[model samples]
Target: MVQRQQVVMFEIKKASEAEIAERGDLADKVADALARAGFAVHRDVNDASGALGAMAWADPADDSGGGVFVRWLIDPAFSRAAVQSVQQGDVESAAFKHFSTVTEQMYAALLAILTSAGFQSEDADDDMSPYTIRVKG
Candidate 1:
């Protein structure tokens, strides 16, 4: 039986700006991270004003924090596995550890990818949440 393990949901939030720009930087970062992690991920975006800017721009890492709004969401299934980590009682450790094991040192890689692209990432103080990413520009 394919175990029905919970999978974390991730997505880049809709970029809503009175000004118009595709705002696909977050998606690019996600693709880089996932690619390095060996997941063939992709991204796409649209301006709330009906502006179709960057189409299919590395759609990966979902609904998360960046630049006063954008965010890099980690999947919940992965998040829980990270929490209940075999290590137990050390969720933060497990969160990092879990993704690390799956993607061969993915956390740092993702962090680097996000930061280099003007996005800042912070691990949650509480293990119950996923890491947050903020964009500088």
Candidate 2:
């Protein structure tokens, strides 16, 4: 039997028109918060097409094949932030367990950071996507 690979995504929703209008500024603040929390942050240079920005960071300890790749993107149209996580290699590999473990830890950390920064959020419903967290600001 083939096991399907799973990708986890979290959406940070903007609550009001004022928040949406200042998405770029909000994204910058989020990036700064992530950086301060020790996540490697890079501003997306190709944002001219309307995306606010993109960021990627990984577990510093997992330099090998065990690490998961995480990305953050701010959508200009919706003024929402999406955080995605995917394993680096084959889904069936033994390292998948490690990937899941690390991914969960990263997600928890991310949620805590965002919430402590004054955003409202909730865990995804069982009927919704697996391991998803929806955040609202």
- 19-89 per-residue lDDT for model 1 (tens digits): 11434555455455545655544342343223221112422233342232222334556655765764566
**Lowest-sum lDDT 10-residue window in model 1:** 47-56
- Candidate 1 Cα misplacement greater than 4 A, ranges: 1-22, 25-39, 42-78, 84-105, 115-129
Alpha-carbon error at 91 in model 1, in Å? 6.1
Q: lDDT (0-100) at residue 5 of candidate 1?
A: 84
Once superposed on the true structure, which residue ranges of model 2 sit more than 4 Å away at CA? 1-20, 45-93, 122-135
- The estimated TM-scores of all candidates read 0.34, 0.43
lDDT of candidate 2 at residue 117, scale 0 to 100:
74
Residue pairs with backbone atoms closer than 3 Å in model 2 (clashes): none
Task: State residue 39's C-alpha deviation in candidate 1, in Å.
Answer: 5.0
Worst 10 residues of 2 by lDDT: 59-68
